[model samples]
Target: MTDGLYPQLADAFPALASEIAELLRADGEPLAEAVADLPYYGPCTCTATCINLLTAPHGSSGSSMIQLERDGMDVI
Candidate 1:
């Protein structure tokens, strides 16, 4: 549960969805089908190397801060 999902953000930031999809694709992930509708409680409040966005996984995986991984094999 979060304030909202990525779709709402995507609607506001036109290029956001495709950009994320492209990143996921480049990382050997399929066409954004999995995380396309993930909810975000808010941005991370830490100093990690990420966009500072916090996402909650549905089950035991718990929560994590989202990072845009690149080049050296990106994985969620």
Candidate 2:
């Protein structure tokens, strides 16, 4: 992870670091990998947002594939 990413994540969602780390490890999919594999051309209109590889070129697809849910509610 980049230095900027950690700070950004810490600021955006303070409680999700551990959860994110676990997911990344369990699936053996790092953030960069997830971002790279994301479907750039799709009919997904979900308003959620995430930081991934596509953002580097597509400049914020205005949506996120990873939906952070907590207590039965979507957090992201």
Candidate 3:
């Protein structure tokens, strides 16, 4: 079985992971152990948050445009 959200989150956003770990540690649960207890299945398609965030367009001064450059994430 695959590791839980923590691993994917850590890999995708280390800064976020560190922040989350700090928060969890303050609650007396270390990140390593906490993540170990988390359940992982497969891709999540239950909510629009993920899809919206991935495909959302961002604008500055003029107009909005789809980002053409993502690290290694597939856009399809």
Candidate 4:
């Protein structure tokens, strides 16, 4: 993921160790108990807000922009 997409996770926890653990569990990937015991901080304040906007689950203004970016359009 881009740093811009997850600036919080990247800045706080470069590896996203906790989120990776959760995803592993959800995907049924066996992980060491110690791995799950690692501490993780949630998204940074700014990134938390961005995450909220990106994952509203109802409506999103940037969805089109995201799609355009995914389609290789230069938003800049």
Give the number of the best model, judged by TM-score. Answer: 1
Residue pairs with backbone atoms closer than 3 Å in model 4 (clashes): none
lDDT of 1 by residue, 15-72 (tens): 7666777777765666465544555545555556656444453233554444566665
- Model 4 deviation from native, Cα RMSD in Å: 14.1
- Model 1 C-alpha lDDT versus the unseen true structure: 0.53
Ranking by TM-score: 1, 3, 2, 4
Please provide, for model 2 over 1-76, each residue's C-alpha lDDT reduced to its tens digit, 9 standing for 90 to 100: 3334323443444355456555555556566334322232322334456344222324354554665555666554
Off by over 4 Å in 1: 1-14, 47-50, 57-76
What local distance difference test score does each model get?
0.53, 0.43, 0.39, 0.38
Query: Considering every candidate listed, which one attains the maximal lDDT?
Result: 1
User: Model 2 has how many clashing residue pairs?
Assistant: 0
**What 10-residue stretch in candidate 3 is worst by lDDT?**
52-61
CA shift at 5, candidate 1, in angstroms? 9.0
Pick by lDDT: 1 or 4, better one: 1
Poorest 10 consecutive residues of model 1 by lDDT? 1-10
